[model samples]
Target: MKGFARRQRSVLGVADALRLGFLGLKARPGRSVLSALGISLGIAAAVAVLGISASSEADLLAQLGAAGNLLTVGAGQTMTGTPAPLPSTAAAMIRQIPPVQSVTATAYIDGASVRRTAEVPAIHTGGISVVAAEIGLPKTLDARLESGTFLTEATIHYPAVVLGAVAANVLGINAPGPGILVYVGHEYFTVVGILQPVTIAPEIDQSALIGFPMAESAFNPALQPTQVYLRSAADEVPAVSRVLPFTANPAHPETVRLKHPSDVLEARAKARTQFTGLFLGLGAVAVLVGSVGIANTMVIAVLERRREIGLRRALGARRSHVAAQFMIEAIVLSLIGGACGVLFGGVATLAYAAVTHQQTVVPAVAPLAGIAAALAAGSIAGIYPAYRAARLEPSEALRSGE
Candidate 1:
């Protein structure tokens, strides 16, 4: 009886508990698998949320990150209806601030993409300066020169255009056509050179980036550039919004201000904090549900294997031995289910990345933590049942069969 305690996990290493737990599972594989499925569902739900949540978080981060780095300042709110967008001059003003470095401004026409049918009615067509490159956006947006080079300040200030990848694909502008003419508002411009394709927001489809002055005159003559962007040294970016009048305040008291992208990133971080609690709540509910399965399986295993427990107890086994064995089985089931779920979650993440063409994010510690928690939950569920099994009297259990 004294030696029986030596065989249990309290004395036995983790490796022994695992081996015995797995052995129990192998002996009753069908029942083990059924029990595992319950936990699998719980893990799957948790992992699914994790995968999608991660993707959404990243997209939001990317946008917000863009805003922060490509530090834009402008009058955020417009008159209720008109929403007079931010003026480009705000960027110049922002640059005047001590911490600020270089700045570029663009006034977006956001012209309705002209099309014969409603399927593709509007695509973004706007103007930007070659100077816009310096203002925090060039690297992330990998627009390469395919047939022609990037627009010069001289070329960009005019109607010379660069097409986005999807835009180029949609507008049938991939190859340089001999007699290609593009019409925006019945106005026509010759296709100079086809710029390479890249990722941009969907709202700006069939879009072309032209020279600043050309875009302003063609799309918005009355308004100055609504979007003003600038670059500060990395360490200097923090002070930029505060230093500038247009961006210093939240309500935007000045003539021009736009929400800096960094604000969006901070908001995203707050959202992740909120979402983490939500996900944990969901996991807790799952753990609760999984506990029921663990309890049910352990109870049934105890009843069905009463003879085995009785024999083991009679063979110099201690009460602790039987209890430990039962608990180990439940824990093993949970851990195995968790491992499978992690693999499943990884696959799901890859699929999402493939379909969306976005980067695949793998949070290394989350899966392991998820599994450990499930095992803990299962152990807790098995406690009562294991206690009952350990307390069973062999003579009374034998007489019950009679």
Candidate 2:
């Protein structure tokens, strides 16, 4: 009894157990690689999905940061469902608000149509609206000109037009230069500028802009402001929005409609978050499948290595030692797969971000969480197999091998 106790105490050291674990994996290199591949693929999928979503969200936030404080005011429909027009003084009224930084307004021309040339049929109006715009519109909206120049004070009274990004494409006009003309309201108006796509103001991207003075002279002298755009200090946006409708229309504040462009963008970001959750669930399913594969592989390994188990038991190795060896092997295999998965996932994220022209943003916790998940999967998968190997009596295992 004393000698048996001494042998049990001498069992297997950590280093020796680790060595045996590695040796077992090396003995069946092909099986080991396949098992690890399963884990790697699952981890990679999870990491890549999270990384890509994060990058996309970061890009959206950056755009919002540029123009999130911009707000739009328009008149709501009257009791008869006819659209109410904003008062001509609405922009001036909004500018009086202490929090308002800048204000500009545009009035849509009812019967005006714009085309590449007068020869084009008026029936093919290309879904584009003609709008009379203020000279300060580009500054108020923080909009960028893609080509040529925006409407200037000097050009406001002339037959000059500025095309929105989509309007330019629809009109087949790439850039504004000398002799570049668009037929507007049955007359030739020189194309003076083309704007870049406005993320915060998509409606502006689809309209053709003409100076207010030009629109009054050529299209309608009685044009009233239809849409009023304003920017406020970032921290004062909410307060400004609350009082904007009242300020824009003091007589009928309820008929004044206010829209936060940033809210629309934020809603889109939230929708993306919901999609990210769905994708994460898919990733989890893949990981579950990989864990099952590892469990199945380990069970088969235990069955195939009965002779080795019996020999080790006969040499006075404790059952706990044998169990620990299998556990370690499973964990090591998963760790290797996890490292590779992180590398592959990170590379995929960077490539996608670069192609999409977005800033890359991977959460620091992603790789760490992946590795932890892999380790946990390994622990769970090794349990039943380790138990089965440890339970075999030395004599019974030897006989089974024979």
Candidate 3:
């Protein structure tokens, strides 16, 4: 009698489990595809958000880096309301600092207005001013001569002057040489060069520049620098900023105004972080909606396949086999969607980067993390349906299907 008894099979082999899992999907291709699509949309949204944000941040950081290590020092009003001026040797003193790369100064010549002709109406000043610049001015500002040459030792004491981009436009002087001249103050200064628009110092755009020596003799014999620009090593910017005011004017440190472009760059980076967080939240909501869709699809599958479950159980199928079958189906469906979503997101990110002229930057973890999340969601959604299918008694399930 014992020899006639049947052998019990408690668990399924890996190959058999996979075959069973795929059978259900193959039987209902349309339903499986629709379910997978929902998950794909969610994964695409998350991946795209991470990719675009990373690329945008990289572009912004690169632009900020282009601003270089620059520091600007200018004069401020004293407690007595007097305009405190920088010392004549301010540039020389700043250069003494080891981290300081180079220094240059410019003095604003008061009551100077440039004009196309001395006959141009005084009221039509064209909003241009005059400044006495040192020989190292262009190097300090990192500016280039668009037309001619910058101030030289021989040209400094003469009537030679350089026009800024805006100043040139204002005076209607396109080409500068020996013949082209613009009236600066009461003197006729020959236009030796024209400078491109300056990014570091925008005020230069609306000002005419002459040599320090010429500015002293013609406009101000007691000429002193009103502003000083300096360059330093990248790591020494903060340390240099703190000691700059005292370095420029040990006598009137309180009256010295010190500023850096790096501060503005940092503020901009902080602003970008806020937008990234908002987009990430939207992506999360999309993923949540996908999980719901998966759960609904799995529930329907269980309800429609009662006959199948009953027949398998009537044979040799166990509860664990049934559960594993449905669970694997869910996971496979999710992975399909996730893979398609990754492809779509990668394409979208590349297209955007090309249009915006920025380098494409995709985080390596984005795709891997997205796939893992999809699998987790699928497994969680499959649990209740798998349990319901496995709990049905074979005779009852078969009869209900009839």
Clashing pairs for predicted structure model 2, backbone only? none
Query: Could you tell me the lDDT of residue 270 within candidate 1?
Result: 81
Q: Name the regions of candidate 3 deviating beyond 4 angstroms.
A: 2-5, 26-31, 60-68, 80-93, 96-98, 104-227, 235-239
Better of 1 and 2 by TM-score: 2
| Residue 262 lDDT in candidate 3 | 59
Measured against the true structure, the TM-scores of the candidates, in listed sequence, are 0.70, 0.89, 0.70
- lDDT per residue, candidate 3, 316-368, as tens digits? 78888888888887777778888888888888789889998788988998899
lDDT of 1 by residue, 116-167 (tens): 2344334433331121122223343333546655556576565455554555
lDDT of 3 at 51: 87
lDDT of each: 0.62, 0.88, 0.85
Number of colliding residue pairs in each model: 13, 0, 0
RMSD of 2: 2.8
* Candidate number with the higher lDDT (1 or 2): 2
